[model samples]
Target: MIVRNCNRCGAAITFVRTKKGKAMPCDAQAMPYRVAPGGPVNIMKPDGELVRGYWLESGTGDGVGYRPHWASCRTP
Candidate 1:
């Protein structure tokens, strides 16, 4: 199980890698939420505010890459 926190809001978004090497959102809640490679995400701020943001993927193709970037978020 992989857990990622929103960089802007500090909300938790969890994921799990499948046997075929695909990353998927965990079904911890009744409503499933996921952050795609270049998709937008909804985050909750420390002050209990909801915001919109996206995950930015970094690193080159030759090495291991990381996911779930909280670089920026916008007000909805």
Candidate 2:
């Protein structure tokens, strides 16, 4: 994982390569989430696998994954 700061928001992030060999910046930490079809948020695995789901903040999750940094970025 390549750790760095966001140029727009300054939040720490890690880059995960996608299946297309593209780097996707994600939050530094992994979060648990439940599968939610057509969800607004996404989760990225260490291996670059991504899933659309809702975060299980106070609830049990189906799996753990990293959140896409752009989804929560402060600056547009």
Candidate 3:
């Protein structure tokens, strides 16, 4: 999946990878998801870099950060 961002208004545009690494449109276009940290996750314009990885806690004291990009968003 990919999250593309809007350069003019900072809106997030989400996309999912298809059969050949092609990103296709999805629900995020109508209702872009916002981040818990007061902002939203999005992909960089032109290059479409990931803005932040979104993850929901499974249980208490999960203490993630196992993968290098796991906690790519915040210090959760």
Candidate 4:
């Protein structure tokens, strides 16, 4: 599992497995970001304790993403 989040906007994230069977996060949802060495990241756990490791940039042109650049944990 990947611990990803957005620094600009505080948000948790969930990913869906691609049809190709790849566990890739949704760019339109949690935009994967470029990690900086030893830099801090956002949290995504229920208590917001899980440290996020990445953020995917999405909805650049449209200005509105399907799920936005930030999100919470997976749903039921």
Question: Please, what is the whole-model Cα lDDT of each candidate in the order they appear?
Answer: 0.38, 0.83, 0.35, 0.38
| Candidate 3 to truth, TM | 0.23
How do the residues 12-38 of candidate 2 rate in per-residue lDDT, one tens digit apiece?
999888888999999898787887879
- List the lowest-lDDT window of 10 residues for candidate 1: 60-69
TM-score-best of 1 and 2: 2
Alpha carbon RMSD to native, model 2: 2.0
TM-score: model 2 vs. ground truth: 0.81
In the order shown, what is each candidate's alpha-carbon RMSD?
14.2, 2.0, 13.5, 11.9
**CA shift at 68, candidate 1, in angstroms?**
11
Taking the tens digit of each residue's C-alpha lDDT, what string does model 4 give over 1-76? 3545644443444454544554434333433343333535542322222343444454332122123223443443
Candidate 1 whole-model C-alpha lDDT, 0 to 1: 0.38
**Poorest stretch of ten by lDDT in candidate 2:** 56-65
**TM-score (all chains, Cα) for each model:** 0.25, 0.81, 0.23, 0.24
Best-matching candidate per lDDT: 2
Higher TM-score: candidate 2 or 4?
Answer: 2
Candidate 2 ranges beyond 4 A from true positions: 58-60
Q: How well does candidate 4 match the true structure, expressed as C-alpha RMSD?
A: 11.9
Please estimate how well model 2 matches the true structure, expressed as its whole-model Cα lDDT.
0.83
Over 1-76, each residue of candidate 3 has an lDDT whose tens digit, in order, gives: 4666544444454555544566544334322222333333432222332334333345322122121122132322
